[model samples]
Target chain A: MSFEPRIVGFLCNWCSYTGADLAGTARMKYAPNVMTVRVMCSGRVDPAFVLDSFRAGADGVLVCGCHFGDCHYVEGNHKCMRRIAITKRILKGMGIQPERLRLEWVSASEGARFQEVVDSFTEEIRALGPMRLKEWAFIPEQVEAAAAAHGE
Target chain B: MDKVKVTIDGQQIEVDDGSYVLEAAKSLGIEIPTLCYYPYMAPYAACRICCVEAHGVGGWSKIVTACNYPVWDGLEIYTDTPRVINARRTNLEMLMANCAPVPVLHRLAQQLGITEPRWKTDTNYTCILCGLCVRICDEVVGAHALAFINRGAKRDVSTPFQLDSESCILCGACAKNCPTGYIKMEEIENRYIVHKEMNLSPNAAITLPFRQAVPNVPQIVRENCIHYKTGGCMVCAKVCPKDCIDYGDRPKFEEVEVGAVVVATGFDSFDPSPMKQYGYGKYPNVISSEEFEVMNNAAGPTGGKIVMENGEEPRAIAILHCIGSRDHDYHKYCSRVCCMYSLKFSHLVKEKTSAEVYQLYIDMRAFGKGYEEFYERILDEGVNVIRGKGAEVVPSGYRQHEEGHLIVRCEDTLIGKYREIPVDMVILSTALEARQDAKEFGRKLNISTGADGWFIEAHPKLAPVSTTTEGIFLAGACQGAKDIPDSVAQGGAAAAQAMKLMAQGEVMMDAAYAVIDEAFCSGCKMCNDMCPYTAITFDDAKKVSVVNSALCKGCGTCVAACPAGAIMARNFTDEQIYAQIEGMLS
Candidate 1:
């Protein structure tokens, strides 16, 4: 409980980002557990971004934008979803919680939504604690010697 | 709360005492032809096609307008009869004698078996003087520029003292309200109907009405004329690559002859701006759902990137659902398109950058096929889905370490505590609203809409695309708020409806049109002057006014106003109606 959980977020330029502005204008406060990145569309968020965020020590990540059919890039959000599905399976195989990665859709006018997702996700990550998968150390010398013996 | 027993068409029925006959009939799935009876607006009873014979109080039967006439205990009503037919026919005949020569009226006249001359024609007649135009202009438009001038036979519609009244703001109230072509609408060939769609900017307003309007050419509203604002600004015309905008000229009417008409009028977006707490128009970054689409579009102002108006990419984003929808404060209907769209935006923002994404919604409605899987995928993609409606959008005005961004505040219901998260952006999934000009368009087509601005479908489930008008159909967002798949499906459905009519090679119209009573027609020609459709024609050889069956809409204005009771609507004879009244009375 004393340790801080790190969360990464990808917000669409149009709806979700403006929603964050609305939150600021309203003076609403939520957990400072999230780091954010802006993208033209949620659909444009490549799977690599989530994997990279995890590699960069993020315990959790969030993606948000306008509602479906309401996407700024038209069908960009749809593509983001398809790509996310593939990445979810890959993360599960990698011994990650998979729950640490999350996707949320927010619009520019939804400031309250911004607060809700951030506050909730932060708590969720806290419950799960820091991602220990990246923290695990492997004995590189032993693995190298074992690999050489097996090959020779 | 006791039910009132009433008899309609020889059947006893129970209805609420205060309910009108039309409402009662609707409850029983009865279709009644009516105009000037919009549910939102006050009933005028100007078009009396729904007139019925009712009795039971002292056995006294009388004809009454069904829309305004309330139901009573032991009341007997007759909707159809030989007598009713005569009255309906005679009324239609009178209306035809006065109507303008529009095709709809002529067709109605043909159905009623009226074609020959029966009354004298008036030469100096164009306006129908139906009083609908005047009332709607005053009541609906909230502008009193137009009024019926003069008195008796010399009565005419004018703006004040017959000159170009300065009070006439040219909002087109009189023209739009006109039942007849009396206040001729200024219809330029390429001019767009400005208020027909959701316009985010003044530029959008100017270019709203163009057909096939993707990147439509903009023109200055003549009344809100930028030239009038500053005395000389031709920026729109100058910037136009096609030289499509003509600033120096006023809108003019151009008549075109066509075998068919396709009404492709689109829909509008819900205005969340009125909910000032959201800070829609007040905030620079807080944009409408559609504006955000434009901002995120490659062809839009931002060239396909998620950024604030200041051109900086956001670090965090939040999406809110159900603006102007499923709320008692606004439309109490679930806008069938918001949920999936929220998911879509979530995926999009996450894919585009490393920013955190959050979806705030009252409910996660992924009922559509393959939608639930998509939702799960988005959740797995590291986007946070919060199950709660947003309470408010406020600015913490926090900057120092966050590069100046907004803080979103809300109670995460699942966790049972308030949360404030600083994010660079927020998005509101605003609901789709009805077109502002829906009423005007309905008037032109002699159709109606629901209490909300969406056009009323003939039947919600069975006839989703058809309208009250027999040949007309609705498609896309015009009928209601729907996703792309549904919109496209409706578009095809409407096309199929039109194709069905065209494939039949003939349109079967209402056979209850007007017929002239040659014996009673005093050759007064008053009816000839009042017809809006111009269905009546005077024969010099016959010395009597004639109606064209193929053009009459059966408005029945001339029938009631007729001094001689000469013309009548088919299936509505005076004698038959009198008999029905007598029968109801006893």
Candidate 2:
């Protein structure tokens, strides 16, 4: 089968999720490869969720939240940023391609930006092909080792 | 109140008569895992994690949720028996099976020794049917926005009909109490987050005042407002408790008659973006002092935390003084407030943050009362007061940390050497200048502006507040750069002058008002129309225009507009102008 990147997006309900809704209402066509999972706030998204997405056969993961200072929960996006930064660092050390995980800020009014980000990120992920975890058989040792290293 | 005997985990404890088993267990130091139960809220038995085996007086034994089951006389409760553990484990397994990805559920399962879930994994939902949010929103907040929708496995908590409800206050109480973090309030409060990278400030379209001033009014800035820009997003109007918001409100104009006017229009902060060497607009951390003041304000973006753009507390800060002020290439005059405010920044930075502050200045102009004492106090606080003008702020080459530091390049005049001080933040104490519309405003008020564009005072010292125009006065920084004390003094002086003018029943008129020659006057009505003050009126019977001396200020517009050459200003007649020109030529 031709390679189609499976991109999982964890979108904060206030900004990015609403932005996606705006994109739909505007009938802005973007890549259909990306599927979104809505969360209350970006801060609610644990780093484990991003890891779980990759483990569950997602080729790419996108965590989008409200812009800085624009978080619905005052500083939720700020917390999201700090956690994502740490998660990216952990992903890099785990030998997983850190580029697969993308964190962006999309406000509620940025419908065009949502379409653009989705299109660009989908194209970038398509170029990278399927994630290594998806192709490899369930190797308990390697997965456990990677998880242990990330836990540190 | 009466006490009741209750046995929790086989330990007999006396509790309030109406207390639940969970509270009685707590009185006897028995631990019960609770997810949906909160002390401030009514007991919600949605999460059955606190299930316990209860024994009745009639020798009946059964499993009951400790959160809602009431304590009674001679009631026995078992919290950690094999049957109770099995019951709790079954409940946790069902929760884990249904909400597999929720970290809180997984944590609770692990704590209860339910390492592996027996049922099939379902990742479709994260909420464990915890009704804390629903209960709190309905009971405490009084906003019945959320409710349990659907039934059984397909059940979910949502706004009625899954539509954006009008009753939602966007108070975020539901989101705050949600154990699974599902109900985001972003839909209700559609505030666009502006300037994300810079961490500058947070603002809504229609916002309340920053400080406690009289009337503490909220105003709408149309440009950034969503309703004004896109004709959408009336969330502010919807959420307002008093329903006081009116999107239909328009700008209004009214005319008022006054004997005197006090021009207290203040100055504007100089924009330093044009000074590329400062790296103000380019650098994320290099901010103006006004922005710093907001950042330091308790009600500001970071809630008064002195953090850099990237959320790191600055280890060192450099306060640059005399930016765009006291420079011949820009403003020629010293912005009198910069030096003191720069010192204040130094004191605040040192007090708030652990940052080592460097005060860069051309000279310390602490000339006001107790100002020198404040300067000495700041000096005692270990602030590095350097005598030098900051040349430029550039990124430091030291990449010791992930975030690069900024280096302030300046000549240390005291040491006669150039020094590059690395700091995380640089606050530019920019100069205050006349508002861009000062000239137009001066012209509209018929007041003379100085060569520097400030409103000219009648006299430099004796009549500082009075303008060249008889009935108008100038106050505060509009006339010159002044600190709070001087501005307040000038305001008082201007108010007193206005009150003095109002107190006088009659005012002396200048002897230079326009006069109409009835013999040569024609009733063309051109002069009457041309008079700005409406001082000239046409006489229909005499066919001549008459001048109202009391209303005229001798502008002589009617003299130029008169087609018959019949109007003449008393002091500015043609013969007097010719004499003045002749005298000037001689």
Candidate 3:
């Protein structure tokens, strides 16, 4: 069967969630690979959620909110940006591709843009194939050696 | 319960013990005239307008002011007897003589059946020694700017030293309370005189904010108002049809609890004064886009004629875009409205005046719907679209009538050469910046601001309107730079989000709140201080820290900071996090 990436999307209530609703209202066709969880804010999406999603066999995770200055909760997106940046680094250390996690800003008015983002992200994840956790065993020395080999 | 029986104006009335005679008479619906007896103020008893004959001890009747006189058991008060009327009439005549030309005193005299003052003085002083101004200044306002100066016949109200007192805040409280209107405030000779520098139409000191909004809603500009600055000039109040102008109106603070909050406090236009190359404030003809907007408005200074400060229409106009915007020196982000508004200005200039228009911009960004079409239409209208950032606006050295003419210097990058376009008026398309109070507002709401000072939303894309703080949302320019349509759409979206939450009836809090292990707790109170939301409270009697589930956001800051390992975040405990990592690898 063709790889259909199972992506967990944490969408903020104010901007990105509305953008998705707009996409649905507009009937703009896009990939249905992402299952959205409505969060009050992108800032509310703890790093643990992303880790938990990966452990639960999700191929990819998407965190979406308002643009930088356009955050509904002023500075919440900034905290999201910082936390996601750190999470990406941690993902890289864990022998996972940082590309598995994505943070995007889709304004409420950008319905078309939201469709484009989801389609493109789903395509990219499909090309990377599924993340099967049962195959890889975590050995501290081997992981360190692999990280050193990767120069990370 | 002892009650005092008092007969006022031939009507017997029962009153609470120790009630004043004025209170007793008021209970019986008997009218007692008073001037210097303001509510919540100490009675001065200066006017004596409420003089009434009270039956005294020894079968004698003495006239006393009803406002200050206390009622006693079996007291009989005559408000309008022949003796009382005569005494009141005599006092009214004396007051009329002292303040003859004053309208309020004249009205009081007419009511007392006195046509004119019986006694005349050479000075013709309007002060009746009511002492209302002096007493109010000291007691109510706390300014103590006025006092009863001199002694006996020479005693009059004056500020200490009779010079401009430094303590005077010029609140106009004393003038407002003056009974006879004897304290004359200096009136501006011509309040409708136009601002000289800008050459704009004359605006009343207190006038409607705009012609479109409610026609009669007047706002006072306290800085330019003579009444606010010098305790003079209440001409606007005197002429108002509704008599709604109140000098005593103070800012009132109110608190309200709501499920959601939408902050739409808009943006501030960037001032181009700091950009000396623009010569905005220094040159009379060089103006901001807002000034141009006003000049283009039909009800504006020149009645929508786009004329120069000297009242002459410009022969050529140069509109500069991205002023203090899209540059590392000022704002790094492109203020989205400037490009389109500059095009609009070009069209307006061409339509209103037969002037040659030039648009100087680094690049044309027509990203919005119908915006690119608008740009194309402006091009069709024969606007000279220059592909370069205007460097400097300088005075044209041409000798013949060079007053309004300015030389705009820029490199025509497309043509590979520098060009100096001489135009009569220069318009700067200034940037829109976050409001100066955005930081203070963010602090008040317990929300955080981005580095650029705009409110940071919960998520940049998904949660555009929602703040980090739940139940609060942002709309319009408060979030970022947005045009009217976008702002309105955001407003509707925010409203809908709030409605959705309200319709849900209950908010589902995160199940990851902190749980305290009471057995392992050492009774140390460190987590209480670490909680940013004040969710952790140390129970002094129980010697344990309690977590408020509703208030806690499950950030795990307290969990990590706990010394005893007593607190564990629900669903995010150390064991759960380790298990997730183990599951990720195996």
Q: Across residues B1-586, which tens digit of lDDT does each residue of candidate 3 receive?
A: 5798888877899888877898788877887877777654667789998899999567888999988888898899998888998899898877765565577666666777777578865566778888988887676656677898899778888889786665555556567677776664432343332212211222335556666666546677565454665465465566678988998886689888788888888899999999999998988999999999999999877789999889999999999999988989999988888999999999999998899999999999998999999999999999999999999999886657565479999999999999999899999999999999997887778665655678877777888998867788899988888888999999998899888889998997968778888887877887787666788998888889999999887756567557688988787676765454445433
TM-score of chain B of 1: 0.55
DockQ of all candidates, in order? 0.01, 0.00, 0.05
Model 3: residues with Cα > 4 Å off, grouped in runs: A1-152, B1-205, B209-216, B220-243, B398-404, B538-543, B577-586
Please list the residue runs of candidate 2 whose C-alpha ends up more than 4 Å from where it truly belongs after superposition. Answer: A1-152, B1-96, B101-124, B127-179, B182-207, B217-257, B310-312, B398-403, B448-453, B560-565, B578-586
* CA deviation > 4 Å runs, candidate 1: A1-152, B1-254, B309-312, B397-403, B537-545, B583-585
Candidate 3 matches the true fold with a TM-score of 0.54
Chain A TM per prediction: 0.87, 0.89, 0.89
Instruction: Report the C-alpha lDDT of model 1 over B261-325, residue by residue, as the tens digit.
Output: 44557777788888877777776777677777777777566777889878888888888888888
Least lDDT summed over 10 consecutive residues: which range in candidate 1 chain B?
B577-586
Highest DockQ against the true fold, candidate: 3
Instruction: Put down candidate 3 lDDT per residue, A1-152, tens digits, no spaces.
Output: 88888888878766788789879988999999888876656766667778778877778988898787656545457777887998899999988899999999987667888899999999999988998753565645667777899899
Candidate 2 vs candidate 3: the TM-score winner is 2
Query: What fraction of the true interface does each of the listed models get right, in terms of native contacts kept?
Result: 0.00, 0.00, 0.00
The 10-residue segment with the lowest total lDDT in model 2 chain B: B193-202
lDDT of 2 at B127: 84
The C-alpha interface RMSD of every prediction is 30.9, 34.9, 7.6
> Which DockQ-derived CAPRI band holds candidate 1?
incorrect
